[model samples]
Target: MGLLAFKDAVHLVSRTGLGAEWDMIKQLEGRSQEDAVNWVLHSAASGLRPTPRMTPWLKLEPMRLNDMKTRNSAWSISQREGKLLQAWWVEQMLATHTPFIERMTLFWHNHFTSSIQKTLQPSLLYQQNLLLRRHATGNFAELLRAMARDPAMLVYLDGYQNTKSQPNENFARELLELFTIGRGQYRESDVKAAAKAFTGWGVDNNTGKFIIRPEEHASDSVTFLGKTGRFTGDDIIKILLEHPRTAERLTEKFWLEFVSNRPDPALVSVWAQQLRKSHYDIQRFMRTLLTSEPFWALQNRGTLVKSPVELVIGTLRTLPYPRESTQELLNLCRLLGQELFDPPNVKGWSGGEHWISTQTLLVRNAYLSKLSRGDLNDKSAAGVKLPNASEEQLVEWLLPVKPLQPLPTTPGARRLVRSLLLDPAFQVS
Candidate 1:
C-alpha cells in the first residue's frame, strides 16, 4: 500500500502491460498500489482499426466443399486473408493506447485456442478476435459461454459437425481439459456427456452465425460432474462454472501468466477461492493479483520468458527505433514460433522456456542486433534519441534483472542499451 518505487512500477507495467513503457511506469511510480492497479484496469482506449476485407464464410464455404480445384483456390485465398488479419492485429498492438487490452485479448485468444489455419476462415477469426476483446477483462463465465458458440471455434474444433447421432468430442474434450479443468479432473465419460450436451450446435452456412438444429439434438439425460440432467451446451457450461476446479484451473493459468512459470500451490488455492467468490469477475481477480505480495516479490522478477509478440511489440513501443513493416512483423512472429491466429496446436504456445530454444534465441538476438545497429554509432545516423539517463537508470529501464553478461566497459548511453538488449536477461520480463 506504500508508494511504488521506479523498479516496482516497471515490474508491474512490464509484466501486466506490453513492455517497460517509460511513461506508464513513471505515471505509476509514486502512486499507491491500489491507484496504479486501478489505472491499469480502467485506462484503455476504445478505438480499434477497421477489419481488413475478408471473403465471407457463406461464399468461401462452398468453394471449399465443392471440389479439389475449388478447395485449392479457397486455401490460397485463406492464406492471403489470414496474413492480412495478422497484420491488422499487429498494427493495432503497435498503435493502440490500450496495450493491456490487446495483451489480454492475446491471452484469451491463446486460452480459447482457435486458428485461422484449422478454421480456414479469416472472417470468422476476425469476429472471434472481437469477441475475445469484448470480454478480455470482463467475466470468465460470460466469455466461456460466448466461446462455446464462436463460429471459428466451432469450425476449428468440429463443433458444427457434432450431431446427435454422431457426437464429435474435440471441442467438448478441450472445454474440460484445457478451458475449464485440467486433464485429471474429468473422465472420458464426462467428455462424452459434454459432447452430447453440445450436439446440434452448428454455424449457419448462409450467415455464419451460431444455429441450434434442435432436431439433431439429443434429449436423453446425461450425467456430468456428478449431476444428472438432459443438458444443453449452456447447461454444460453452467455446470462447469459451478465446479470448484474450474476457478482453480483459471487461477493456476493466471499465476503462470502474471506471477511465474512455477505456481505456488498455497497461493493458487487462495487466489482461486477469491476468484470464485467474485463470481469470475476478471478485473476483480486481476486487482487482487496485481496487489498481491507475490506479484511484487524480488525473486519473481525476470522469471518469465517473453513471448514473440511481447518481444517484438514491446521493443518497438519502448524504444525509439523504427518499427518493422506489418508484413515483416508477421514474419518475425511466425519465425519466432508464434504466428498470430495460428497457434501450433490446441495447447497453444508453450511460452515459458519454450520461447527460448537455441534456434529462437538466435533469431531473437539477430533481430535485436539489427534493430540496434548504427543507432549506437558516433553521430547516430539513425537519429534515434534514447532517454537521457545515467547507466544505472538505463539498465533499470531496459532490463528486469542485472545484465547476465557484463556491461560494456565503454561509456555511451546507446552502447549501454545495446549491450542490455543482447543480454540473456532481456529475453525475460
Candidate 2:
C-alpha cells in the first residue's frame, strides 16, 4: 500500500473502531500488513463488556403510578436495558484496541435493530446483543437464523403472535425486504408464502419463553421463491440465506458501514464473492476486505462522518476523562441523538453525516470545555489517587493541541480545551 494510503487505512480503522488512542495508532505506524491484521483481531479477549443495570423499571419505579404501574415498570426496565447497552458499547469503545471488531458489532446492531420498547425486557435485549457480539465475525447463514428466532426479535417484530388462522406477515416481509434478499430481489407472493410457513411461531405468554405451537402453525403447502412445499419460517430463512441476493445485500450493507460510505459496486462484488466462497465466515470476510487494495484507497479515508456515540465515546477515551466525570458525559450522549439502547427508530440512528449537525456540534464543544474545568481528583479519599493520566511528563499528556499560537494562563487553558474539542481531527479518528 502507498504511504498516504496506509495512513488512510489507519484512519479508517480508527474511525471504525473506537476513535484511535495514540498508543494503538503508534503500534501500527510502521507495521507490516499481516502484523496489523493480527494485532486488531487479538486486540481484546472477547472484549465484550457487562450489561448495564438501568432499566425502565428503575427509571419509573420511583413514580409508582397505581394504575399504570406496568407502564412505569416497563419504562424502568427499558432504562436499565438502555444503560446496559450503552455501558456495553462504551466498554468496547474504551477497551478494544482493534477497530474492525467494534465496527462490525456496530454494523450488526443496525442491521438487526432491536428495541426494548417492544421487547419489554432487558434480558431479551442483553441476550440479543450477546448473539450479535458472538456471531458478529462468523457465518451469515447461522447469524441470520439465530436472529430470526431470537425471543427478543419475536416480540419486536410481532412474529411471536403469528398464527395459522391469521399469520402476521411483518416478520416475513422484513426478513426478505430489510434483513435478507431485500426489495426487488424477491416477490410479494414469496413474502405471503413465507408468512404462512411461519404461522404459530411465537413466544410464550406465561413465562415469556419461545413457543412453536404446531397446531397454530399453518399446515397447507406454500410456494416460496419458485419452490412449492410446506416451508416454515426456519425453512424460509435457510432458503434466503442461501440465495445469491442475500450475499449481495449483506455485502453492500457491510461495505457501506465499515469499508466506505460511498460503496463502489465493483468493490462490493469483490467482497460478495469472497463471502459466498467462504460460506459467510464473518471475521474472514472482514479480514479479506481489510487486507484488500481497494479498502486502503485514500478516497475512503476522512470522507465519512462519525456518529454521536462514536464522537462522544471516542473523545472520552482518547482524552482519558476521569471516571467521576462520566454522568454528565452520558447526558451529552442523550442530547446527541444516540441514547445508548434507545435508538431513534427501528432503523437506528442514521449515523454517518447526521452525527455532526449544528446542535450536536455545539454540545461536543461544551463537553470538552467542561473537561478543562475539572481537576482529575479522587473525591472519596484525602490526597487520593489520580485518574489514569495524572502525570504530565509524557509529550502527549503535556501537549494538548491548542489553536492559539501562544497558550495563555486560565483563559488560555479553557481556549485550548475548546480548540481541542473543535479540532476536526477530534471529530474523527
TM-scores for all candidates: the values are 0.98, 0.81
Error of 1 at 200 (Å): 0.9
For model 2, the superposed segments whose C-alpha errors exceed 4 Å read 2-9, 44-72, 88-92, 95-100, 323-326, 372-420
Model 1 Cα lDDT, one tens digit per residue, 1-429: 599988889898999877888888889999999999999999956699987999999999999898899999999999999999999999899888878999899999999998888899999999999999999999999999999989999999999999999999999999999999878888999999999999999999899999999998999999998899999999999988888899998998888899988888888888888888888999999998988888888999999999999999999988888777889988998999999999999989888888888899999999999998774556464648777778898898889899999998978887888899999999998
Task: Give the number of the best model, judged by lDDT.
Answer: 1
Candidate 1, residue 32: CA error in Å? 1.2
Q: Give the local distance difference test score of model 2.
A: 0.67
Candidate 2 residue lDDT tens string, 77-145: 666666656666666666665556666777788888777666666667777777887777777889888
Best by TM-score: 1
Question: Which sections of candidate 1 miss by over 4 Å?
Answer: 379-383
